[model samples]
Structure formats: C-alpha cells, structure tokens
Target: MSGLIALLDDVAAISKVAAASIDDVAGQAVKASAKAAGAVIDDAAVTPKYVNGFDASRELPIVMRIARGSIFNKVVILLPIALLLSAFAPWLISPLLMIGGAYLCFEGAEKVWHALNPGDGHDSEAHIQGEGGGVSLEESRVAGAVKTDFILSAEIMTIALSAIPVADPLWMKALILLVVAVLITAAVYGFVALVVKADDFGLGLARRGGGMAALGRGIVRFMPGFMKVLTIVGTAAMVWVGGNIVIHGMHELGMHQPYQWIKDTAAAAALAVPQVAGLVNWAVTAFFDGIFGIILGFILIPIATKVINPLIGALRGLFGKTEKAGH
Candidate 1:
C-alpha cells in the first residue's frame, strides 16, 4: 500500500513538470509570434491578392492550398534549418535576420516608390483577371504566392528563433519553434481566408431583409477602405520592423551610432509626455527606425535590381544547365 502511494506521488510530480513545460512552450510561442508581427501582418495582407478575381467558390479553396504550402514551408523546410542553426550556428542568426530585414525594407520602399511614380510597368491591375485561365493560372499563382511565403516564413522563424532564450533546452527550443510555425501559419492564413470571403458573407446577409442587411451593405462598402488601410498598416509595419531589426543587428555588431542616437532621441521625446512616456518613446523610435529603413531600402533598390538580381538569374541558369547535364 505504501509503495502504491509512492508510485502515485511520483506520477503526479511528473505530470506537474510536464504541465509546466507545456505552459512554457505556449508562453514562448505567443511571445515569439508577437515579435514577428510585421511579417505576420504582411503575410496576411499580401495573401488576399492571390485570390483576387477568382470566383467566390474558388477563393477559399485557393486560400487553403496556399495555407498548406505555407505550412510546408515553415514546418517541413524552415523549422529544421532553424533548429540546426540554433544547435550549431547560432551566431549566424543575427546576420541572416538582418538580410531578411533588408529585404522587408526594400519591399516596403519599392511599394512606396511605385505608388508615387505609378504605371512604370508596376501596375497593380496586371494581376490575372476574369477567372478564364483556369487551373494553370491558379496553380501558377499559388506557386508564386508560396514562394513569397517562404521568404516571409524564413523571416518569421528567424525572428522567433532570435526571441527565444539561448539557454533553453534543445527540445524546448524545438517545441517553441514548432508552436510558432503552426500558430503564425494558422493566424495569417485564417485571417486571409476571412478577408477574402467577407464580401460574399456580406452579400449573403444583404439578401436577407433586416438590420443584418444594412450591416451587410455597410461591410461591403467598408471592405475596399479596410483593405487599403490593411495594406498601409502592413507596409508601415514592414519598414518599422525591418529598420528595428537592422538597427538592433548593427548594435549587436558594435556599430551603434544610429541605434544610440535613436535611443537618445526617443528618450528626449518620452520626457515631454511622462503620462504616456512609453507610447511616446516607441513612436519616436519607430519614426526614426522607419526613416533609416527608407534610406537603406532606397540605397539597396538600385543595387538589388542592377546587380544582385541579374547575378542570381545567371547562377540559377548555370545550376539548371548543370543539373540537366547530370541527368
């Protein structure tokens, strides 16, 4: 009887530890997700465009396919790479993160440049319209979107990985990353699904006579403006987050001029509004970081277009020929 009681006590203790570990994983996952908010918002904002012009019935299905591809990108591809880095090459994370950050900055700035200059072969209306191309177009769009998602997912995973404590056990780190991957994928794609389907939902309600009909009409009217707002917010977030990442990376590498200057400026701003000091500090910091991001992004655009892009294309061509020769 005494032995049985001791066994039960031991089991209970193990259960407690397991519960605690699960809690820790959940907490870290949420924290890491928040850290990647810019990428998350951009992912959600950008995904809807892929489904544009599709029939209402096809929109959800297309979203599902993209979501599946995103899941595969994050879990099957990125998670392993992230874990290996964490386990062996942790020092590389910050540099890789900065690269991702620069990409985000470039993307945001390019959008702004295009917006200001319009119709320089960058027309937004060029996306395939009228739903006539069928499965090939759908497949092509999904493939392209998935490819874009891979880059964003890389950023999300790297940011999440960086947010985690280095002293965490390997298994715990793995668990946290796994949770981050699943959570971010679900949240981003889930929002995309809703955004794409919202008009149809609103139309459905509009057909029914009641207060719901008015609400439905209101939703229909609201969607376009809401989409614009979402895009603006996503762009702003990308630059701010990207700038912050690069600044932090530079600080880590002991080049702290802009980071320190930005900090001092933010502190000065915060002093004027003690009641909302935290908000003021953050706003000031984001403002400067965004300015830095814009400058860096503009600098990178010409180099990326005139140099890096052509080089990448040539390398890809070379690799393709080599593979063909081997086969």
Candidate 2:
C-alpha cells in the first residue's frame, strides 16, 4: 500500500510539472507573438489586397492558399532555420533582421511613393501575369504574396527567437518558437479571412431586415474607409518596425549613436509626461524611427530598382538558360 501511494504521488508530481511547463510555454509564446505584432499587422493588412479582384466565392479559397503558404513559410522553412540559427549562427540573426527590415522599409516607401505620385509608372505587379491572363494572374498573385510572406515570416521568427531567453534549453526554444509560429499564423490568417469576407458577410446581413439591416449597411459602407485606414496603419507600422529593427541591430553591432539618441529622447519625452509615459515614449520613438525608415527607403529605391533588381533578373535569366540546356 505504501509503495503504491508513493508511486501515485510521483506520477502526480510529474503531471504537475508537465502542466506547469505547458503553461510557461503558452505564456512565452504569447509574449513572443506580441513582440512580433508589427509584422503580424502587416501580414493581415497585405493579404486582403491579393483577393481584391477575385470572385467572391474564390476569395476565401485564395486566402486559404496564401495562409497555407504562410504556414509553410513559417513552419517548414523558417522554423528549422530559426532553430539552426539559435543553435549555431546566432550572431547572424541581427544582420538578417536588418535586411528584412530594409525590405519592409522599401515596400512601405514604395507604397508611399505611389500614393504621393499616383500614375507614376511604378512597376509593382507587371511581372505577375503572362499569356494566360486570369489563371496566371491568380497563381502569380499567390506566389507574390507567399514570397512577401517569406520575408515577413523570417522577421517574425527571428524576432520570436530573440525574445526567448538565451539561457533556455534548445528543446524549449524550439517548442516556444513552434507555438509562436502556429499561433501567430492562425491569428493573422483568421483575421485576414474575416477582413476579406466582411463585405459578403455584410451583404448577407443586409438582406435580413430591421436593425441588423442597418448594421449590415453600415458595415458595407464602412469597409472601404476602414480598409484605407488599415492600409495606412500597416504602412506606418512597417516603417516604424523596420527602422526600429535596423537601429537596434546597429546597437547590437556596437554602433549605437542614433539608437541611443532615440532612446534618450524617448525617455526625456516620457519624463515630461509621466502620466502617459509609456505611450509618449512609444509615439516619439516610432516617429523618429519612421523618419529614418523613410529616408533609408528612399535612398535604396533607386539602387534596388536600377541595380539590385536588374542583377537579380539577369541571374534568374542565367539560371533559366542553364536549366533549359541541362534539360
């Protein structure tokens, strides 16, 4: 009897420990996901645009395809790479993050440029379609969205990896990141699904009469303006997060002038407004960071379009010819 009781007690203790570990992993995953919120917002905001011209029935399917690609990007591709980086090339994380950040800045700035100069023949989606216009367009959009997601997913995974403590065990780090990846992808895509189908949802509601009809009409009327606001917010987030990442990466690399300056300025602003110190600090920091991102993005635009893009195209052409010859 005594031996059985002891065995049961040991089992119970192990169960308790297991439960606690699960809770800790969940908590850490949530925190890590929160840290990657900027990227998450961008993901959500950018995805709906891909479904814009598609038939209403096809919208959900398209979003699902992109979401699946996003999961593959985060889980199959990025997760293992993130784990490997954590295990071996940890120092490479910051530079890679800065590269992702620069891309974000470029994307955000390009949008801004287009917004400012509407009709300026910017080659945004020219390569997305071919001879078979409709089918090719859809496939190309999905591919483009997936390609964009890969960069954002890389940033998110790296940010999550950085959020985990250095003292954590390898398995624990992997588990936490896995949780973060799954949870963030689900939340982002779920929200995107809702955003894209909201008009249809509203129309369904509008068909049903009474107060619901009014509400439905409001939703239908409101979505366009809401989408505009979401786009603007997403753009600002991209610039702010991108700039902040680069500045912090510079700090990590030991060149911390602007970062230190931003920190000091934010702190001073916080001190000036103690009641809303946190909000003030964040707003001030984001403002300067956005300014820096805009400047960097503008500087890179010409270089990227003229030099980097041409080089990439030439390389792709070379690979295409080589593969054809081999075939």
Candidate 3:
C-alpha cells in the first residue's frame, strides 16, 4: 500500500509539471506571435486579393490550398531552418531579419508610389484581364499567393524565433514556435476565409428581403471601403515594422546614431506632454520609423525592379533551357 501511494504521488507530480509546461508554451507562443503582427497583417490583407475574381464556390477551397501551403512552409521548411540557425549561426539571424525588413519597406514604398502615380498601369484592369483560361489563372494566382506567403512566413518565423529567450531549451523553443505557427496560420487563413466569403454571405442575406437583408446589403456596401482601409493599414504596418527592424538591427550592428536620435526625439516629445508621455513617445517613434521605411523602400525599388528582377528572370530562363536541353 505504501509503494502504490508513492507511485501515485510521483505520477501526480509529473502530470502537474507537464501541465505547467504546456501552459508556459501557450503563453510564450502568444507573446512571440504578437511580435510578427506586421507580417501577419500583410498576409491577411494580401491573401484576399488572390481570390477576388474567382468563383464564389472556389474561394474557400483556394484559401484552404494556400493555407495548407503556408503551413507546410512554416512547419516543414521554415521550422527546421529556423532551428538550425538558432543552434548554429545565430549571428545570421539579425542580418537576415534586416533583409526581410528591407523587402517589406520596398513593397510598402512601391505600393505608395503606385498609389501616387496610378498611370504606371502595373496593376490596371488590363493586367487582371490578361489572356488566360480560368483554371490556369486560378493556378497562377494560387502559386503567386503561396510564393508571397513563403516570404511572409519566413519573416514571421524569424521574428518569433528572435522573441524566444536564448536560454530556453531547444524543445521549448520548438514547441513555442510550433504553437505560434499553428495559431498564426489558423488566425490569418480563418480571417481570410471569412473576408472572402463575406460578400457571398451578404448577397444571400440581401436576397432574403428583411432586416437581415438590409444588414447584408450594408455589408456588401462596406466591404470595398473596408478592404481599402485594411490595405492602407497593412502597408503602414509593413513600413513601420520594417523600419523598426532595420533601425534595431543597425543598433545591434553598432551603428546607433539613427536609433539614438529617434529615441532622443521621442523622449523629448514625451517630456513635452507628460500626461500621455508613453503614447506620445510611441507615436513619435512609429511616425519616424515609418518615414525611414518609406525612404529605404523608395531607394530599393529601382534596384529591385531594374537589377534584381531582371537577374532572377534570366536565371529562371537559363534553368528552363537547361532542363529542356537535358530532356
């Protein structure tokens, strides 16, 4: 009887420790996921456009496919790579993060430039109406979305990895990142599914003819403006997060002038309005970060479009020719 009681007590203690570990993992996952908000928001905002012209019935399926790809990207591809980096070349993380940040700034700045110069016609109606069969178009869109998701997923995983403590056990870090990956993927794609189907839901409601119908009609009317607002917010987030990353990376790399200047300016602003000092400081910091991001983005745009893009295209072309010749 004494032996059995001791065994039971041991089991109980083990269970308590397991439960506590699980709780800790969950808490850390949420905190780490929050750090990647910029990438997450951009993922959510950009995904809906992929399903925009698709058939209503296909929207959810398309989202599911992309979500699956995203999960694979995060778990099978990015997770292992992230772990290897954490274990070995940890110093590479900050530079890679800065590269990702620069990409974000370039993307956001390109959008802003396009918005200002709508005559560029890069995303004009004609581009959408290009000669392609519906199935092919769908495939192309899905592939494009998946490719974009891979970049955003890399950013998210890196940011999450960075947020984890260096002293954590490998298993704990893996568990925290895995949880973050699953939760973020579900949140982003789930929200995307809702956004894509909302119009259909609204249309159905509008057809029913009642108070519900009016509400449905209102939804239909609201979605366009809502999407525009979402895009603007996402772009702003990308710039802000990107700029912040680069600034911090610079500080880490021992060039502290920009970061110190921004800090001093924010501190000065905060002192001027001590009542809402924290809020003022954050806003001022974000504003300057966003401006820096915009400027960096603009600088990168021409290089990316003129040099990087052409080089990539040539490489792809050469690879395609090599495969053809081999066959």
Candidate 4:
C-alpha cells in the first residue's frame, strides 16, 4: 500500500512537470511570434493582393491554397534550413538576418519612392491585374504570393530563431519554432481570410440578421476604409520593423551612431511630452525608425533597380536563363 501511494505521488509529479513544460512551450511560442510580428503583418498584407481580381467565391479557396503553400514554406522548407543554420553555421545567422533586413528596407523604400514619383513601370502592376498569358491568372498570382511568402517567411523564421532562448535544447528550440511557424502562418492567413471576406460577411449579416442589421450595414460601409487603413498601418509597420532590424544589426556588427541617434531623439521627444510620455516615446521611436528605413530604402532603390538588377541579369544571361524582377 505504501509503495502504491509512492507511485501515485510520482505520477502526479510527472503530470505536473509535463503541464509545466507545455506551458513553457506555449509562452515561448507567443514571445517569439511577437518578435516576428512585422514579418507576419507584411505576410498578411501581401497575401490579399493575390486574390484581388478573383471572383468572391474563389477568394477563400485561393487563400487556403496560399496558406497551404505558406505552411510548406515555413515548416517543410525554412524550418530545416533554420535548424541546420543553428546547428552547423550559427555564424551565418547574423549575415542572413542582415540580408533579410536590407530587403525589407528596399521594399519599404520602394513604396515611398513610388508615392513620391508615381511614374514607375506598369508591367509590374500588370501581373496583379491578371494580365499574364496562357496559364490561369489565379495560378500566377498564387505562385507570386507563395514566392513573396518565402522571403517574408525566411525573415520570420530567422527572427523567431534569434528570439529563442539559447539555454533551451536544440530540440526545444525546434519545438518552439514549429509552434511559431504554425501559429504565425495561421494568424496571418486567418486575418487575411477575414479581411478578404469582410465585405461578404457584412453583406450576409446585413441581409440575414435582425436588430443589428443597421450595424451590419455600417460595417459594410466601413470595410473599404478599414482595409485602406490596415494597408497604411501594415506599410508603416514594415518600415518601422525593417528599419529597426537594420539599425540593430548594425549595432550587432559594431556600428552604433544611427542606433544612438535614434534612441536619443526618441528620448528627447518623450521628454517633451510629459502627459503621454509612454505613447510619445513609442511614436517617436517608430517615426524615426520608419524615417531611417525610408531613407535607406530610397538609396537602395536605384542601386537595386539599376546595378543589382543589371548584375543579376548579366549573371542569368551568362547562365542562359532570364532573371525575373521582384514584384
């Protein structure tokens, strides 16, 4: 009987330990996902464009396809690469991170460049409008979105990998990253599905419901504006996060002036706003980070378009394959 009691107590302890481990995994996953929120938001923002011209009935299907592709991208492809990097070439992590950061900077800056100049090539935009030949336009868009997701997912996994606590075993890190990969992909795509279907949902509610029908009508009216606002927010987030990564990467690589200036400037701005100091600090910091990103992005646009593009073209030309430009 005493032995039986001891066994029960041991089982209880094991159960407790298991529960704690699960809790720890969940907590770590949430924290790591937060670190990669920028990439996540960009992923969400970039996805909707893929289904833009498709029929409403096809929207969810396209999103699901993209989501499946995203899962394959993160879990099957990027996750292994990430783990291999962690194990074998941990030294490559920082450089790869910087490369992703620079790409983000370039993308954010290109948006600003377009807003400022407005007279760029239309061939790029034509793909979004479903103008490509032969293959179903939907397939092209899905392929393009999946390609874009690959870049953003690479960044997301890297950022999540960096946030992982080094004390944890490589297996633990892998588990956390797996959780993050599933969670972020679900979240970004889920939100995207909601965004793409908001109008339909609202219309259905407005038509089929009762007392809240007026509210549904209001929602139906407001969704367009909300989408636009979300787009702006997503863009700002991209710049802020991208700028931040590059700034922090520079610090990691031993350059500190830009980081110091951004910090001091944000601190001063916060000091000036005594009543909303916290909000002021956050706003100031984001503002400066975004501004820095915009400037860096603008500087890179010409280099990317003229030099990098041509160099890439030449390389591909030498290899007898045409290099495609990023959309």
lDDT of 3 by residue, 1-327 (tens): 999999999999999999999998998899999989989998998889888777898999999999999999999999999999999999999999999999889888988988999889554123333347588988887788888899999999999999999888899999999999999999999999999998999999999998799999999999999999999999999999999999999999999978999999999999999999999999999999999999999999889878998999999999999999999
User: Clashing pairs in model 1?
Assistant: none
Give the per-residue lDDT of model 2 (tens digit) for 11-45. Answer: 99999999988898899999999878778888888
lDDT tens readout by residue for model 1, 86-172: 999999999999999999899888878887888677433244332447788898788878888999999999999999999999899
Clash pairs detected, candidate 2: none
Alpha-carbon deviation at 193 in model 4, angstroms: 1.1
Distance from true location, Cα of 253 in model 2, Å: 0.8
lDDT of 4 at 321: 47
Q: Give the candidate order by descending TM-score.
A: 1, 3, 2, 4
Kindly list the per-residue Cα lDDT of model 4 for residues 34-120, writing each as its tens digit: 978777877777678788767798999989999999999999999999999888898788888877877887886676666667777
**Candidate number with the higher lDDT (2 or 3):** 3
Candidate 3, superposed: residue stretches over 4 Å from native: 121-131
Candidate 4 accuracy as TM-score: 0.89
RMSD after CA superposition, every candidate: 2.0, 1.8, 2.0, 3.8
Regions more than 4 Å wrong, model 1: 122-132, 320-327
Clashing pairs in 4: none
TM of each candidate vs. truth: 0.95, 0.94, 0.94, 0.89
Q: What lDDT score is found at residue 322 in candidate 1?
A: 100
